[model samples]
Target: MDSLPNLLWLRSFEAASRLGSFTAAGVELGLTQAAVSGHISALETRLGHALFHRTTRKVDLTESGRAYLPAVRKALQDLAKSTENLFGGKISGAVTLRAPISVATLVIAPALAAFLESQPELNIRLLSAIWADTALETNIDFEIRLGAGQWPGCQAEKLGDDFVVPVCSPFLAKGLKTPADLLKLPRAHILGFDDHWPRFFETLALPVHSPTPSVTVDTSIAALEWVSSGGGAALLLERAARPLAASGRIAIPFKEKIPLGQGHYLIHRQNAPPSRPAVRVTENWLRELFGS
Candidate 1:
């Protein structure tokens, strides 16, 4: 096409098509019904085809309108997204990253400050999920999840290895000498993970005959709390247990760390709605800090 239709005209066409009336489109666009009709008429003159079929009670999309609506809608969407990405409200940036509680609290929380310091304009929001291994969430800017680094409509990068290691209070930890010693204690199963205790036993060739849990909890944080009270031994992610072990609140009685096979992945849903530069900077910081 040599000449493009005016945006106001295209807007009128799209609004009228969507709402099924020029009067309603005019109401929406703050124009009179005649103005909406005039826009469509001018557009029809330019395009050499009528976009709407009109009657006394209603208006309907013509065959040409049906064909053209999708492109026009997509073009409008692209323009809006481009405007938001390039020049929208990011003077003082805001980014929301969602991750598992253990990873968020233990792994990233300690190091997140330095990242913010480096990029002084950002306000970072960390949303904690107990079961963070599932699907991509809408409106989440970044995700740190424990999984196989795969999801639809996303970019998943390997953050690092995660291993399941048994942890308990210092007093209880001192009493254990062998893998067999663990079998006698009550086991607090972290519910979201694989059957870690059974796998942990089998990894050491210590047979478990119908292994049962003393307690079950959804989050590693809860399991850690239970173990710290000397309630039972809980198998926890190595990253989750690392800080507490350093503080002497919990102890890793055995040297063996069972590979989880899956691990924490830094995931970004690529351009579903494109991210701003600050969020992109935070994404890079997370990858650099956590990625293997």
Candidate 2:
């Protein structure tokens, strides 16, 4: 029993069983279909057990194979990830970070250059998508999330509050003098936040009505773009809209703003301890940036 089957054969068998196609496994493993088949056959011969039920169209894992597949797949993946961590290069590895597209583009992307300069060896892979509850578990090292500051099963740090105010293009601000004047100008809405308009109206002591908008966007950044392009006024976070305000593209119409909770947080999985570099860099940078 000292002479075990090749590790490559186990990898090929695991991939084939998981993917349900030798050809697909070959594509993933960078081997030919014949080579993958040979590896699986070799593993089966060594183990004296058929691992898969092969048919004309597909392959299904046998009971023994199903039992063995998870451990094999996890081992291989852990090996690959650990190898990347160990000898990848320059005492640096990639940090997979996730954030909303608006925050990523407006806030984080601008500050990234300075961070990169500070840590010349490290690499960052940024992912921007819709806010999801399960983001920390999805192969991401860190996530910048905007919500009510109540995320469970994650280590959380408050980034800042999201102060939302009505803003429009500098050109559109000509006739808009007060909150009452806002009723005349075309408005823009961000979907899934139906209370944004209502909250603003309530703050201004106006009755809630079905407000018509010139444009509706799924993301806040897009709404800002519309406002900047002279499309209409938008309710946007002060942190994100400040740059455009500085550039003379947009102007906040009202002095009174609605506090939309602590808008952003940096979160990571609670179960897994962050790597040394990840924790150090993230914690220091956030403290410097947000004064936390």
Candidate 3:
């Protein structure tokens, strides 16, 4: 009850920390950048520590800010959920969702504007994640993960499956007439996802040999960029590759794609169902959008 007066200031701090920009947080919170800065400054004055490292270009979280953010975010969610549950389930606050960078770019980013427009009262913060198995933050409301739909303590629902095909720039793809053509040319292996190159060649009944790649990358997005820049042929997920192919950035040399053993899923803690009707509705909307 003592901290109730500072609720708005806490929210401003959380938004700025999460977004990494005071201006961006201001836009989201419908406040002027100067006003947002004042709120943060006032909060910092009360807390007796700087929460952000101010820079000429952008703001970044200080060590103390990073430690405080999750607690603030969880408190906000709990308060919003409890209030909504008491008030007949009207969804009004934000939902924090995390997904892979590739998926965020390919699927959600494009559709998000219209979705937000339709649900004016609901806010969604979509964070780009690098790893599927990264530590699940206590404050995250939904996670879009790629796996067998079995998160330790979460309820997982399959969103969709994806497959990878050998792709290259239009100029490079022009020379490749057959699968064997890929073997002769330079190939860039996306370390984790393209470990199946040997198996794919085996499925084609070609003699299995260790492929010496022209280069190797850590993520599918980088591999796509490398291939699209005429770096070399590489295996990329069809969902990601198809758009690149359509946009003339890359081409699939063959229609055949190797099915990945895993799929994307929407997961949340099993013990903690979303108490807001709006959140539950959004969950249903995600299932429908992904065809679950």
Candidate 4:
């Protein structure tokens, strides 16, 4: 038979290592300090290794204990989660999500109804912004941001490149022949994407110009709304434009897709894991939707 330490002893050892004090661990485990110490002592004897260094101020993990902690912690967490999955009631909680306004409007907002229908107990607080600060917001549980794949004090998961294409209404597109013809119509510009049109024209070997009667919007969704309404032509991010184009409400005037330096990223605070189990579920849903 394979030998295994008692589960009770493992619990005492893990708690002591995490709290750094046998008395505190005992209090947390609802046992006397002596019982906690005895459990760990018994565990160490079984394993033939000291799990912690005896100290006057506080107990410290021994080299052996340090090596064993990660496995023990993970095992305990897995067991608890499995128990909950099989027997626990539905997870009910609010999850705060922040993303670019364009993504929230066109992509996530449209699909969220079905997601919520499946988990009626789940409450999602979806927030949108035209631009995100360099730092991740402490209040947000998840953030889908648009930027370069690097942010200070953040773990940025690059989703996709910022691919954009010029789109206009079908009526407006009928008058176009080449890239330069885009200049003849009103050029709708989205704020915070100043480099898009300039780089696009420069790439196609045409001089970039801002024409009169042009409109500017703060969000890509706004630009798409303007373009779909035949307000003029606008260069839109692929993710934002996909739904409208597929519905046949808009037309892609050029085959050229300008690949920008920045793109969509899933943001997390550096060194901080999610605070709730619901966060993991919500993240998986978003990642699946984004096809990342």
Candidate 5:
């Protein structure tokens, strides 16, 4: 005879032993009372000992059943927790997310520390890149981009709208009075991008002229850093610049803002489901934070 009992049989035996009645165990376990009694009898026969003292008035555990109860209960508890950890809503794994430099710095990075604390078993790899190209790197679990909700071979959900205004150091804004005055100062424009400066001038109903930049940078975060170091005025996103401006890191020199009409979006592969729990949690958190 096998030394160990079947898992289901053991479960039935444990239930019957704890409840002190095969009928009560059957009700709890969704089994017939006869089935519960059979399981307990099989377990008792395998162990070569009677686990229960049958009685018409009330059933009771024999000394052997009492001794075996704690170990079986603990085993069942461990199995339940292990099953939950494997297949339940609680997740443990790494998620790779990619986004623009400024969004990574101003938006995601600020809230990430707390998020990691809450999900101790989860780890993340955040990459900073321009969202201009729709073709993201392979193996990227998630992405944040600025565009209409139409990326070929991917899924896109609109996060929210973004706008920009001219910002500079306090010293740079000291003598600046109006939008016209901003034109004469050496402006900092993002290289390979004409959206902010041209749209800004067009919003003011002025002729779009390419003004020479004191410094041309590749990313918005770099441009903001330059402006903070007294480089020159830069057109920066309103959401990203607000906190810095409030902290005196950078000052918005103009009251006018140029709206792009294009919204930010969360991106992932088309028809690809998020298999990892961490990915689902992070995606939900981002949607909550950035959704209008």
Candidate 6:
């Protein structure tokens, strides 16, 4: 017998040892039970030792098999990962992306057509959250965030500055000529948790205390819809509200704009390698959209 055992035989033995049955290993490997049993027997004979104690009902690994299990399992895992990496797994396979709901709806959704056109082979899965709630170590490939430039232990790229301004329907814009005129109208506030309206009011010189809004919403998109429906005036990001603004659904209430404190950014774990398809799609599309 040759000193070196067959790789296929070792694979069969490892699967049988972990599953505790040749029949189960056969199911997993897509082989017949007899084939699996023969492979394990061949491995044991080549090594001059019995790897498992087989009975009519079940199989148990011998002491030598137990000692060898960990190394074999780790080797197999490493080989599998390497094979996937070699076969464009990181680029063509599933890519999970996380982003804020507003950004995902307005920015990413509009730009996705171009991305899909360029890289048809890649599959993208998008996850939207109200806040930065995604666990980066999980299956997520990347995260797009709206914040000041400071994400620790991650590779960050600033997308664009998020600017906010008061937006109202054309019907509501009729009497709203000055900043003081805003006090007479009902204002829509996004309530669950964002400082957009508060920060916007701070930019004006007038002593305008935030009114207990007539309509309170949980999302920027919802607030935009309310404004479009002629419910009330809402303060929304210029980028997110641009589409509606262009369509004449909503109008900017004031000539002066307010800074919303931060910009949109794309982030990924520093230790993790970036997915090639994700990087290519994001960079090219955002550059075209934002002219950055």
lDDT of 5 by residue, 16-135 (tens): 766677898899789999998888888888889988899985578889988887788778767765675787866778899988777898878877888889888888899887645666
Candidate 6, residues 115-226, lDDT tens digits: the string is 8776776677878988784346557777887777577777778877667778889888887888667767778877544645545555675655654788887778888788
Which candidate tops TM-score? 4
Model 1, C-alpha of 109: deviation from truth (Å): 2.3
How does each model score on TM-score? 0.65, 0.63, 0.63, 0.69, 0.63, 0.61
Better of 1 and 6 by TM-score: 1
The residue-level lDDT of candidate 5 at 209 comes to 56
- The alpha-carbon lDDT assigned to residue 29 of candidate 1 equals 84
Whole-structure CA lDDT of model 5:
0.78
Query: Which lDDT values do the candidates have, in the order given?
Result: 0.81, 0.76, 0.78, 0.81, 0.78, 0.74
Candidate 2 lDDT score relative to the true structure:
0.76
lDDT for 84 (candidate 2)? 52
**Candidate 2 C-alpha lDDT tens digits along 1-292:** 4766789998788778767899988997899999999999989998889999999888998999988777777676677658756875444667787888887887778778988887777788888986557537657877888776677777777876667888998888887877877777778888655547777888789865556676888888788888888887788877767776887979986787888755688787753432445544655686566542
Segments in model 4 whose C-alpha atoms lie over 4 Å from true places: 1-92, 209-213, 273-275
Which scores greater on lDDT, model 2 or model 6?
2
TM-score of 6: 0.61
* Candidate 3 residue lDDT tens string, 1-292: 6655398898889888867788988997899899889999999998888999999878998999889887888888888767756875445778788888877776777667878787888888888877776457778888898877777867788877777788889998888888878787677776555376787787788764546677888777787788778888888777767767888878888987778877889887653532456666576677766662
